[model samples]
Target chain A: MYELIKNLGTWLTSGSSWTGTDGIAHRLAEHLQYSLLATLVAAAIGLPIGLLIGHTGKGAFIAINLASFGRALPTVGLVVLVFLAGGLSMLPVYVALVALAVPAIVTNTYAGMTAVDPDVKDAARGQGMRGHQVLFQVELPLALPLIMTGLRLALIQVVATATIAAYVSFGGLGRYVFDGLAQRDLVQVLGGAVLVAVIAVTLDLALSGLQRFLFRHRTA
Target chain B: MTIDWSWIGDHTDDLTTLTVSHLQAALSAVFFGVLISLPLAVVAHRIRPLRGFLLGVSNILFTIPSIAIFVLLLPISGLTRTTTVIGLTVYTLVVLLRNTVEGLDSVPAKTKEAAKAMGTRPLRTLLTVEFPLALPVIMAGVRIATVMSISLVSVATYIGDGGLGQLFTDGFQRDFPTPVIAGVVLTILLAVVADAALVALQYVLTPWKRRRA
Candidate 1:
């Protein structure tokens, strides 16, 4: 255990310098930025579609099947597909990550909307609330918790998968892991693993906090 | 290059063989995962402190990238079926263990108390009462783990394990769209069919859900 700790420490500090072309910190930051941008793009598109489909309740099966297909599509495969289609660099990575995030966001959004208490919706409608007004005023607020849950799940997945973008020489933290493996450096490999684990746990905790905050606000 | 359906049609046998291999890897991983996680979950549930530690470890494991895990394990397991199965099994623990604990915990306290009042042994009570009640949630976790393993197994192709990922890698290497598209389509189909089968199994195992369905 002590040896393990020492190795981990050495790896984390060894990669501290960013003077080289492929600095771990620089790669991490770039990967994170790409992941965040991709997730935001996915949420922007997914949330609206989720809301529209969820509101109409007409295409639930199709929406769900599409999302399931999205989830099943491997990130690496998608990245390869995008690359084959003349998309390389960060664009393919972004597209793949967005594709991955969409299903969760869409599913959760639809579920959250549909799960809104029927009585509250009916009461809002009875009180001269237009369809749009009820959705905006009541449904969206109530569904915020679930929607946030979906966002949280999507965020973690995006961050974890962004490492795969390194395979295309896009220079993400996955470079550390893959390159380390190629070079047979356990220290470097462990460092990359530690960085990813930290990001995932931190994001998860932060999102849990956000979920709690949304739930509390909804009740209050 | 123009798409060639004829070439793919001729290679349907190859596709079927690859699908079989993929299913073998996923099932082996899920089988071992459930075997290990169930007992550990039961033991952890009985001991509160151990439960927290187990859950923490599993949660940490959950965050590790599947490819990274495979890469790390390959040196020790030597690019064999053992590496892929072990890596995927570890991944399943993060999902299965949590669900098992949650499922058991969700069993109503009153049900357990009544069983004890009838002089049922602790083990017997757990098997007879708690296990049945928790079957649905446990099955749900198993379903998720199965799907996850299937998807992650594609990455195992990097370590010389052949599956649908072979198609993807081969396609990429040769710049052939047919194999890549075929691999993607097959993977999606596998996931959907597996998901549907699990849903059916869940229905069979938990008859109460049938009413809801």
Candidate 2:
């Protein structure tokens, strides 16, 4: 056990820590940039679609089904599909992440909008608030919490699934985990896994904090 | 690149076999997950400290990458049905445990008091009052777990385990889009069906939610 601890300690302090230049950190950053971009793009597209579907109140079933279908498309499978379709670069990764992020955002946005207090909406309209004004001032603020919940879910998923980009040589922390497995390097593999868990938990906490900050008034 | 319909047509048997296997794995995982989580949730509920510890542990487990779990388990257990089931079951724990606790907690205090006032035994009250009230939330957790298990089963292909994942890995290696597409399509279909069935079950179990609807 002491030997085991010693080895682990050495692995942690080794010069070749996965985050060294040309290593895990650089790769992770690249993947994160792409994943974040994809998720943001997905939020841009999905949030509006969700809001529209919720407002019209006619296409709830369709919107929900579409989102479910989006979730059903496994990230890795989508990546392979894009790879086969002659787009093997980060484009495939980005597209897959975007696709994966859509369902949660859309579902949450719709739910959040519809859940706004009917009385508040009516009051806004009674006060001569225009449709757009009511939406921005009354609906959006009320719905923001749920919308943020969806975004948080999407962000966590994007971070978790972005590791799959390693399969396409896009070089994320997944490289360390997968390559470590290939080489039977438990230290590296465990380290990478630990990093991912840490990242996910940290992001979750940060989002929870942000959600509290944004929705404090409502909760209060 | 043109789409290949003929290839998909030719591999229908293989596709069906893979889908069946994938469904089998997911169902088994969910079964075991519910089995383990329900008891654990009950224990945690009875013991507040245990509840906090287990909840944190499960949350940590939930964030651990599915691939990492697959990799870590494969060598220890070897690539077998047991490994896949165990890994997926652990994955479902976070969802199932939370849902179970939430479900049980959702039962009204007045309802429990009524049961007690009627001189119902502890076990009887749990079965007739608590469990029944918690069923909807529990079912919702099961729905989520089932979907998660289905998706993770596909990732299990990395270890040469389970059916649909086999199709995915094979299709990727051979550059055959047919099996891959078939596997993805079937997986999606299964998720939709499962989700709808669970929603229906939730409605049946909690008529109040239905009335609200």
Candidate 3:
């Protein structure tokens, strides 16, 4: 344990490791790029459909089934499949990340929207509100917490899964991990692992804080 | 740019071998995951104070990306099936443990009281009344775990013991699309089949709920 920590400390503190194109900054940026792009795309696709289904109470069965099936689809398997079809490209990585993130967002959005108090929505409609007005003004505000939860979950999953891009010879924090593994550099491997864990934890904490804030704001 | 579907046909034997082993590994993980989680979940439920900590640990475990789990386990178990299985099992623990605790918790309050009033011991009540009631929920968790483990088992190839994941790594290494597509297909197929069977099992187990509905 001491050895692992010492090595990790050394790898982390080394001046050369923190700068330039091959450094931690660049890789972290790459990691964020994949995760954020996937998240945005998934939100674009999942949020509206989830909103419609939750609002109109239509096509939920198919949406639920598709989301569940999405849960079953393996991230690494999809990454590999796309990587093969596309051949050592960023396209597969982004596609895999998007596929991996979509289900959580869709499911959570639908659940959140459906969970909103119908009487509250009814009041909004009773106040001369249109369909879109009731949805955005009432349902959307109420569903924000769960929707955020879904986005948080999806983002965390994407960030973690993005590490696999290194496995496929793509550039990211995973390069530190996969390359370190290949070279038998335990320090580098653990360092990379710790960094990825840090990213996940940081994002989780931030999202949780956001959700809590939303909850407070909603209740107040 | 093409799948070379013929290549898949040509490698039927290899594909079958990978699929079966993948299923075995994932199933073994789920088995061990349930075994470990059942007691821990029960303990957490009964203890009350420990509930938060147990769930927190499991959540943290779940959050640690799958690759990191396998790699972290490598020092202890090395690049072996033991590591891969342990990694997969740990991943399933959070899902199953949370499900188990929630399932038991969801058992009706009156049902417990009835069992107790009937002179049933705590353990007996748990066994006879609470557990049966919780089966549907717990089984759903198991279904989730099974499919998730199947999905995650693809990353276990780094430990050199993964089933279909080996095909993916091999395909990527060889720059061939056939094995990659085959592996993805087989993994998804196993997940769907296992999930469908579990859903069926849940339906069979919850006949009372169905009748009420």
Candidate 4:
């Protein structure tokens, strides 16, 4: 363990490791691009579908079952499958990561929207609010906490899965771990593991804080 | 770039072997996860402090990416199924434990009181009443964990212990799409099949819930 930590220190401190095309910064950028693109795409697709289904109380079956189905489709398998079909590029990785992410967002959005107090929604309607206004102004705010929760879950999963994109010869922090494993370099493997963990932790904490911010209105 | 159907068809034996291996690795994790989590969940449900600690630990474990967990364990267990299963089991613990506690907690207080008022022993009341009532929700958690384990076992291929994941790696290396596509479909099917079976089991166990009002 000491030896592993020492190697990681070497990897972290070395100038070459931190710069150039194959450097940590480059890999970090690659990881972030995949994660951000996947998250954006998933949110764009999931939030709308979730809000629509959730508001109407329609397609509950699809919303609920989609979560399990997404969970079941192995992310790695999906990555490989897309790579085979779409060619060997980061697009396959993005598609796979997006698939992993969308379900959580959808399910949470549905649940959050559904869980809003009916009286509150009825009041919004009983007032002069139009349908879209009621949905956007009242329901969305009420459901923000849960929606944020879903986003947080999806983001973490995407970040985690993006690491494995390295397996397909894509650039990411996972490349460090896999490349290290190939060469029997424990330092590289641990360095990559630590970096991914840091990303996951930071992302989760940020989302949790956002969830709290969204939630503040609830009790107030 | 295109699939070779004949290649996949000729590999039926290989497919079955891989499927069973995947099932074995994943299911064993779920089985032991339940065994380990149920008791802890049961006790934790009634004890608020313990509940938080258990959930906190499991949640932290859950955050560790699947492949990271496997790689983290590689040093300790050295690329064996032991490391893979342990990693898988850790992932299942949070899901199972939370579901178990939630299901048990959802059982009506009145029902427990009624069981006790009937002169039933506490342990028997818990076994016959609380557990049966909790089974449906608990099964839901089991379904999630099982599906997750099945999906994750494919990632375990990195450590040389992939179940259907081996097909994925092999297909990629050999420049063949057949095994890769087959592995993807089979993994998804395994998840769906397990979920359906669990749903059926839940219905069987919770006949009261099935009755019309």
Instruction: Judge candidate 4 against the unseen true structure and give its global Cα lDDT, from 0 to 1.
Output: 0.88
What tens digits encode model 3's per-residue C-alpha lDDT throughout A1-220?
A: 7777777898898989979987988999988888898899989998998899999999989888877688778777778778777676788888888888888888899999999988998888889999999899899988888888999999999999999888777778898898898998987887787888889978887888877876874662
Colliding pairs, model 4? none
Error of 3 at A30 (Å): 2.1
Error of 1 at B37 (Å): 2.8
Over A95-210, each residue of candidate 4 has an lDDT whose tens digit, in order, gives 89989999999999998899889999999999989889988999998888889889888988898889978988988899998999899887788788878878887888777777
Model number with the top DockQ: 4
Better candidate number, 3 or 4, judged by lDDT: 4
Best by lDDT: 4
Per-residue lDDT of candidate 3, residues B1-213 (tens digit): 677878877888988888888999999999999999999999998999999999988988888888888888877888888888899999899989999999999998998998889999999998879888989889989998999888888888876878998988888888887787778778888999999998888898778889778
Alpha-carbon DockQ of candidate 2: 0.48
User: lDDT (CA) for every model shown?
Assistant: 0.83, 0.80, 0.86, 0.88
- State residue A87's C-alpha deviation in candidate 3, in Å: 3.8
Q: For residues A44-116, could you state the per-residue lDDT of candidate 2 as single tens digits?
A: 9899998887666779998877765775676777787777676567887888888889998999999999998
What is the full ranking by TM-score, best candidate first? Answer: 3, 4, 2, 1
> In model 2, where do residues sit more than 4 Å from their true spots?
A1-9, A18-21, B1-13, B43-56, B196-213
User: Against the hidden reference, what TM-scores do the models get?
Assistant: 0.87, 0.88, 0.95, 0.94
What are the DockQ scores of the candidates, in order?
0.50, 0.48, 0.67, 0.67
